[model samples]
Target: MPIRSEWKLAREGWTLDTTTRLLKATAFNPLITLPLILAAKYTARGAQVASQNETLFRTLKSLVALGVLGSISGFLDDKVVNNWKGDEWDWKKEVVVVTGGSDGIGKSIVLLLAEKGIKVAVLDVQPLTYEAPPSVQFFQCDLGSKEAIEATAASVRSSLGDPTVLINNAGVARGKSILDSTEKDIRLTFNVNALSHYFLAHQFLPSMIQRNHGMVVTVASLAAYLSAPNMVDYASSKAAALTFHEGLAAELATQYKADKVRTIIMCQGYTRTALFEGFAGKSLYPETVAEEIVKAVLKGRSAHLVVPESSWGIVPRVRSWPLWMQYGFRKGLKNLMKSWKGRQVVQPSETQVEKEKKGVEESAVLVEEH
Candidate 1:
C-alpha cells in the first residue's frame, strides 16, 4: 500500500518548523556541547594529541557560546517580545462558542477544550462526528445565513450563558476560478467565510466589552496572503476575514478601551483534513494547528500566528517586492494548485439528518413570528 501524504510528510520531516526544532535540539543543544568539551579535554592529555586539541577546544567553546545565546534569545522572545502569560479569566467561567465545530480543525479545537473541562458550544450545520461529553453542546446553525446565526446565538446564550470566547472557524472553499464560479458559489463562500465573522462579533462582542474580558479567534489561511488559480473565492474571502480580524482587534484596544479582550488571527498553511484531500505539497496536521490556537488563547495575548513561522516575514512583505517579482511568485503559487482535487461534496451523517429536521421546525416557527 502507498503511504498517506500526511504520514509520509511526518516521517520524512517535511515540515520546516518541525525540522528546525529537531535541528535545534540535537545540533545546538548545550548538553551536546558539554560532552564534546570533556572529550576534547581527555584527548588533549593523550600522547597522540596534535593541533587537533586546539581546534577541538575552540570549536567546543563556540558551540557552548551559541547554545547559551540561543537559550537567552528564546527566553526573551517568549517573555519580552510575545509577552505571553497565563489565562486571566477563570476557565470554569469561560463559555466558548466555536463555529463549524462538526469537523476538521474546529472539531479538534472543540474536543481539546472539552477535554480541559471547559464549557463549549458548537454552532455547525453538520452533526458531530464523535460523541461529546456533557461539557460540549451542539447547536445546529447555518453560518452563511445571518438570521440563522442570530437565532442560534440566542439559543446558545439561553443554554450556556454569555460566551466569553468566540471562535469564528466556519468556512467554505469552492475550488473554482473567477470565470468558473457561479454567483451562488461566490456568495456562499463569502457569506460563510467572511461575513459570518461580522455577524458573530456583533452578537457577542458587546457583552465582552461590558465585562472587559473575552477572546475572539479567527482561523484564516495562507491563501489570504497568496492567491492561487482555482481558489479565487476562497482566497478573497480569507483576505477579507484577515482584514476583519485586524480591524476588530484595533477597535477593541483603541475605541472600546478593552485590551484584556484578546484577539488572535491564525494564518495557517494547508491542513491535513478531508476538505483538502487531494491538495499537494506539505501540510500541517489539524491537531497541531488546534493545539497552537488553544495555547495562544490560554496565554491571554493578542497575536497574528503564521504556521511554519518561516512565512512570518515573507508573506507580509510580498507586496513590497517589484511588480514583476510579485507576478512571478503568484504565478508559481497558481501552478501548484493546477493538480488540486479537493473534496467536491461532503456527505452528511445521521446526526446531521436529525439536526436538519430540528432546524427546519425551528426555522418555521421563527419565520412565522416575522
Candidate 2:
C-alpha cells in the first residue's frame, strides 16, 4: 500500500517530528557537524579579534565549544559500539534475510536492499504485497514454529547462499491485559518476538562467526524499557529480544572472537504500520526506520539505535528514574493505545505447538550428542 501524501507532508512539514530531522542532520550526522564546528570556530575568532560585540563573540565561542564536544563524544561512542574495527561490506556478495518482509518496515528493508543489487530472501507467511524483483525471493514460513524456521533457513541457504545479514524483525501483538491474555497469546508473542531470535541465530550465526563477516539486526521497540498496560506480553517479549541482542554481541566478540561480525539492535518508538493502524501519539514513518537499519548494515558496524534520536536521552533512562516518576510516566501512557485497532489477535494453533515441541526435543538430543 502506498503511503498517503498527507502523511508524508505531515512527516516532512512542521508537525510533531519536525525537530527529529534537524537533530538527525546536526546531532546524528557528524559529517555535517564537523563543518559547522569549523565554521563556528572561525567566526568566533574573527569576532573576538575585531573587537566586535562581546556577547555575540561569547555566544559563537560557546556554540563552537559545544559542537566540538558533541563531535568528539559521538566519534568515541561510535568506536566503542563498533568495537574499534572497520568492515567493508560488498553489497554485491551480500545475501540478506529479512523476516516478515512481506509488508511494513520489513518489506521496505527488503526493497531497499534489492535496490542496491543485494540478494534478499524474505521469510513470511504472507506473500509480498507487490511484485518481487529479480533480486528478491519470498519464502513462506510461520515464525512462531521452530521447525518451520529451520526448514525455511535451509531453503534460504540453498536458494540464496548463506545469509550475510539476518534481520529478526517478525513480531505480533495481542492487546490484552495480563489476566485476560490466554496461554496461547502469551506463548505466541514470545515465540515470534523473542525465541525466534534464538532459533534464527542458531541457524545463521555459525557461518557469520566462522567468516567473521555478517550482521544481525534485531528490531525491538521502546516498550522494552517503558512497559505500559494492555500490551504487557509485547513489552516482555521485546525486553527478552533486547537481552538476546546484547548476549549475541558479547558471544560473538568474546566466545567466537568474531569482532567483525556486527550486531545492531533498534529500540524504536511507535511506527506507522498496519500493525499499529490506529495508533495515537507521535510516530515514525516505516521508511524512516528502514533507512536507518539499512544504513547501519551498509556501514558494517554494530550500533544500538533509538529512533527519532531525540528520545535517546530519555527513553532508555526511564528505568533508572525514581519509582514514583517511573510510575507517573507509564501512567500517562495508559490511553496511548486505547484506540488501537491494529493487527488482530495471534493464535498459536495446536499443530504449531506440537511441531515446536518436536523441534525442542530434537534440539535437546543434538545438544547432548555434541
Candidate 3:
C-alpha cells in the first residue's frame, strides 16, 4: 500500500479513534479519492473534501485487503515458517532491579516483570500505582545518592539474591534551556540521569563481575541527538549516558575481559507514561516499549540503539549540511517540540531522598573483595 502523508495521519487517527469505522464501507470510492489525490486541485474546499474522501477510500482499501489476503496468507505462512512455540521473554529466573520503578516507563517494567514470575525489586521514592506480584519487593532507594544506593543494595541483596540484571532506569526531565535552568536543576539532572548509573554499577557490577554474568540497561532518549532547545538539561544528561554506555561496554569487554557482563543503551522516543502525559503524542513504534525494554534487558546483549527507521538516514554523519537548509531545519525542530514546556517536566525530589535511604541500606550489605 502506498503510504502517502495524509494516509499515515488518517491511519493513526483511525487507530486512535474507532468512531471512523463506518468510513470502511467506502472501500472502492475512486471518485471520492480522485480530486486532490489523483488530480492537483489547489482550492481549499476541494483539498479539504478530497482529503476527507481519500482517507475513507484508503482505509476501506486496507480493511478489504486485510480481509482478503492478510488474514489467511500472513497467518498460515507464519505457522509453517516460524516457531510459535517459545518462552516469550521469560523473566522468571532473573532478579531484575529497576530504578524509577514507581512511575512512567520504569513503573511499567516493574509491573510486567512481576507478572512473569520474576523476582523483581522496585526502587523509587514513590510507590507503583499498579499492583505487582507478591514476590516483587518495593525498596525506596534514590539512585542519585551513593549513600542511599549502598543502603538499598544491602536491602536488595538480603531480600533477593545478587541481582542478575540491573536496569539503570531512573531519570528526570529538566526540560529547561541552559539560560533558564537553575544551578540545582543542572546538578540534579546529571546526578539523577547520568551519575546514578555509576552508583548502581558499583553496587551491582561486582556480583556480575564475580559470576561473569549480568545485564546493565541504561534508558536514554533520542533527544540526545536532536538536543532540542528546551531540553538542554535532559539532552546533556542523556548524551552523557549514550557515551557512557559505549565506554562501559568497551571496559567490560576489554578491561575486565568479561563480555558476559552485557550492557544495553535504550535511546527511546515519547512513551505513554505519567511522566510524558502532557506531551502531545504517543508513539506506537520505534520508541521503547516498556515490555520490550524488559525483554531486551533480559536478553543481556552488548548494545541496542532503538531508533525509528526514517531517522537512520537523517542522522548527521557529515560535518556540515547544505548552507541554505540549515536555518529552516533547525527552526522546524524547535517548532515541532515547541509545545514541550520545560518547566512542566521537573526531576522528582523524593528520588534523592530514596538515594539517601539506600545509602543507609547499603551500609548493611557486605561485599567480599576480589
Candidate 4:
C-alpha cells in the first residue's frame, strides 16, 4: 500500500537523508543498474556506433565497479565485522516469552511464533482478545509491577520451562507534556516502558548465562532519538530502554563472558496500533515490525534494527550536529504530532462482558467434564 501523504511530506522535509535513501534504492541498486548497463552495451553493439559507445562503456564500467564495491562491503559486514555467528535454534526446545503479547506488535509476534509450533507464553494485563492456538499460553500480569513480573516469571518457569527468548514489548504512552502529565502518568510510563525491562532481565538473565545461550529483544521507539511536543515522558522512557539494552548487552559480554547470548534493540517508528490511535504520522504496519523481529531472532544477531531504514543514518547523527540544526530537525518532526488527537478510552459493552462471563462458565464446565 502507498504511504499516506502526511508521512511522505514529513520524510521529504528531511532533505539530505531522503535524497541519500533515493540514491541507494536506485543508483546503488544492482538489479536496476546491472540491467541498464546490459541494455546500454547491447544498444551500442547493435547500432555499430563507435563515438556514442564511449558513454556506454564508461557507464557500464561505473556500474560494475559500484556493484563490486557494494558486494565487498556487504561481505565484510556480514562475515567479518559482525561477531554474531548464527546458532541453530530448535523451536521444539525453545520457550518464547513476550510481554504485552495480547495486542499490537506483541500480538503479531505471539501469533507468528505460536504458529511455528514454538511454545509461547504471553504476559500482559489484559486477557487475549483472540483465541490462541494450544502452543500459546496467556499469563495475566501487570508489567509495571516488579512483584507481579517476578511471580509470573516463576509461574512461567514451572509451566513452560525457562524462556530462551525474552521480548520486552510492553509499553505505555500518556501523550502529555511534562507539565500536563500527572505523577501517576509519569510513573506508569516509566515503569511499564523502561523499568520493566530491567526487572525482567534481572529475573531471566541469570538462567540465560548459566546456559550460555539466549536472546534478549528490546522494542524501543524512534522517539528515543527524536522527541516532539506532548511526548516528553514517552520519549524519555524509550531512551532509557535503549540505554538499558546497551548496558545489558555489554555486561553479558564482559561481566559474564556470555557473548553468545544475543541482544537486539529495535527502534521502530509510529505503528498502526490502538496505542497510538489518534496520532497522525507515517506509521508502519504491526505485521511488518513483527516480521523483522522474527527475522532478527532467527539470525541470532546482536544489532539495532530501525524501521524505515532511512532513519538508520539520520538518527545517530542528529545529536552530534550544530545546536541550531538539531533544533530545526526536531521542529520539523514536531509538526507530525500537531494533528494528534489522543486515543479515547473505551469501556467494554455489557453484551461483551456477558459473552466473556459465558465463556468462563463454559470453560469451567469443560474442566469438570474432563
Candidate 5:
C-alpha cells in the first residue's frame, strides 16, 4: 500500500515542516534550547583543549545566541498578537455551528466536538454521511443563498441557543477557466466560499460582541495565496475569505472592543476529499485538517494555520517575491487541475437572486394587516 499523505506529513526528520517545527519548538519553548546551550558549552571546551579551534567554538556559540534570540522574539510575537491576555476556555457551555459538516473535514470536526460533549449544529446541503451522536444536529442548508443562511440561523438559534463558534467549512469548487465558467458557477463559488461569511457574521457575530466571547474559523485553502490557471473563482473567493478573517480580527479588537472573541483562518494544502478527488499532488487526509481546526478551537485563541506547516514559509511570502519569480511559480500551477475529477460544476437548486427574495419573504412578513 502507498504511504498516505497525512502519515507522510508526520515522517520523522523529513517532513516539509520538520525543520520549521523544530525551530518553533526551540523558539517558543525555551526548555528545548537548554540542551543546545549545553552542547555549545561542551563543544567550546573540547575545541579549546584539543585544537584551540576558534572556528568550531564560534559556530557553537553562534547557535546558542541565535536560539536565545529566537526564543525571545517568539515570546514577544505571541504576547503582542494576543494583547497579553490569556484564553479562558469553557467548553461545556459552548455551542458550535459547522457549515458543510455532513462530510469530509466538516464531519470530522463534528465528531470531535461531539466526543468532547460540546453541542454542535451541522449546516450542510447534504445529509450526514455517518450516524451522528445526540450532541450533533444536522440542518439542511444551501450556503450559497444569503436568505437560506438567514432562515437557517434562526433555526439554529432556536434549537441550540446562540452559537459560540462558527466554522465556515462549506465550499464548492468549479474547476474551470474564467471563460468556461458560467455566471451561475462563479456566483455559487463566491456565495458559498466567501459571501456566506458576511451573512453568517451578520446573524451570529453581534451576539459574540455582546457577550465578548466566540470564535469564527474560516477554512480557506493554499490557493488563497497561489492562484492556479483553472481555479480563478476558487482562488479569488479564498483570498477574500482570508482577508475577511484578517479584517474580522481587527474589527473585533478595534471596532467592537471584543478581543476575547477570537478569529482563525486555515490556509490548508490539498486534502483528500471529494473537493480534490483527482488532484495530482499530495493531499492531506481530511482528518488531519480537522484535527488542527479542533485543536485550535479548544485552545480558545486566534490563529492563522497554514497546514503541512512546510508551506507556511513559502505560501505567505509569494507576493513579496520578484515579478518574474511570482509569474513563474503561478505558471507552474497551470496544470495542477488537469487531472481534476472533482465536482467540475455545481448547480444550485435556486439562483442567488431568487433565494434572496424568497428568504426575505419567508423570514419577515411583507404587508402586515392591521
Candidate 6:
C-alpha cells in the first residue's frame, strides 16, 4: 500500500491573524506561547519562535507539560475503543456471505458461522485451502470490480440461493503515508472498502427486501473516527464507508420502508490479523473475538464492535474533546502510527500462497498462540 500526502501539505492559505485566532482559542493554550503563536501564526511561527528568547521559563514548562498530557490522552483514546467482550453466537438457520473470507477477520467470521451450522459462502479471489464445513461454500470473485462482483453474485444466487446476511469484509490495508501511495492504491481502497458494498447490496438485497429480512454488515475501522499520520487513504476510505452505511440504514427505514433489512457495523481496533502489519507486537485482542462478534451481530443484533474488548467506550467520544487536547493527543499518537507500516495490503488477487512467496509476514505474532 502507498501513502497519500497531498492533503497534509496542501497549504490552507489562512492569514496570520486567522491562525493566531485558532491558537488563542484552542483549549488550555498557555500564556507563554500565546504571544509567540500570535506573532508567528501559520507561515512564520517556526522561525519566529526560534528567534524568541523572551518567554518565561515557567510558561515554557507549562507548554511542555501540555505536550506530555496530549500524547497520553491521544493514546488513551485510541486504546479505549477495543473493549468489546460479548456473549456466544447462535447461528442456527442463518444464511451468510462473507467477502475476503480467505483469511483474517473474514476467514474467522466464516469459520465461526460454519461452526454454528449456518450456511456460509466465502467469497474471495484466492482458491480456498481451508476445509469448508458441510454448510460452507467458497466463491471466487474480484470484489473491487463491479462486473466481477455482479457475475459472482449471480453464480452465488443460482448455486446457494440468496443470502440473508451480507458481510462486506473484503478490505486492503494500505499503511503508506498518503504522499507515498499510488493513485491505484487510493482507487482500490475506495472501491473495495467503500463502493463495493453498494454493488453487493444491490445484487443481493432485492431478495432480502422481498423476504422481509436480511443483515448487512460492514467492517470499518477505529481509524475512520480518528486519523493520524501514515494511513490517510485507508482511514479516509473507511470513513466514507461508515458514512455510506449510516445513510443507507436511514434510507432503508425511511424511503424504502425496509426496516427488516438490518444493518450492523464493526468499527474494529487493532486485532491479531494478517491484514494489519507493522503493528505486530501490540497485545490488543484475539482476531477470533472479531469473528464471534460478527456471528453475534448476524444473529439479530445491531452493533458497533471494537476489538480487544477494552477500548469500546472511549472511541465514540474521542472527537468531542477541546481543540488543544485533541491536537496534543493526536501528536502523541504519531509515535504509535510509525509502527503502522508493517500492515500489508491484502488485495483481492493476493492469496496465502502468493503472500508467503512474496515474503510478506504477519504484523506481529498472535497475542494468543494456539
In model 3, the worst 10-residue window by lDDT is: 361-370
lDDT of 5 at 253: 88
Rank by TM-score, highest first. 5, 2, 4, 1, 6, 3
Per residue, candidate 5 scores C-alpha lDDT tens digits across 1-370 of 1212433446233665766666655553446545644654578764354356666545645666777787787678666656566767788889999999988899888998898889999998877889989899998887878888999999999999999999999988877899988676688789999999999999999999998889999999998998989889999999999999989988888999988888888999998887777777777878878888988898887888988888877988999999999999999987788888674222244444545655312211111111
Full candidate order by lDDT, most accurate first: 5, 2, 1, 4, 6, 3
TM-score: which is higher, 2 or 6? 2
Q: What lDDT tens digits, residue by residue, belong to model 1 across residues 117-145?
A: 88999998777878977899999887878
- Which model scores highest in TM-score? 5
C-alpha lDDT values of all predictions:
0.76, 0.79, 0.63, 0.76, 0.80, 0.66
Residue ranges of candidate 3 with Cα displaced over 4 Å: 1-92, 280-288, 307-309, 315-328, 341-370
What is the clash tally of candidate 4?
0
Q: Which stretches of model 5 miss by more than 4 angstroms?
A: 1-14, 22-53, 344-370
Angstrom error of the Cα, residue 1, model 3: value is 31
For candidate 5, what is the TM-score?
A: 0.86
Model 6 is weakest, by summed lDDT over 10 consecutive residues, at 1-10
Q: What is the total number of backbone clashes in candidate 2?
A: 0
lDDT of 2 by residue, 252-293 (tens): 888999999999998888998777766666888888788778
Q: Over the stretch 12-52, how does candidate 3's per-residue lDDT look in tens digits?
A: 24442232323432432333433324343567776676567
Clashing pairs in model 1? none
With candidate 4 superimposed using the best TM-score fit, by how many Å does residue 350's alpha carbon deviate from the native?
A: 25
User: Scored by Cα lDDT, where does model 1 land?
Assistant: 0.76
lDDT per residue for candidate 4 within 63-174, as digits (tens), equals 6778768877876765431354555678889888999898899988888887778899999877786898889999988786888889999999999988989999988776
**Who wins the lDDT comparison?**
5
Score residue 341 of candidate 6 by CA lDDT.
Answer: 46
The digit string of per-residue lDDT tens for model 6 on 1-370 reads: 1121322321223333334445434533545454545455454765566457446534554664674575577556433321121223335655789988877777777776676678888888766648878988888887778988999999888888888888888777666667877665677778888988999988988887776577788888887887777777878988987887788777766777666667777787766666665563344343444454555565574555654334445655678989898878767666555665433334444334335564333434111111
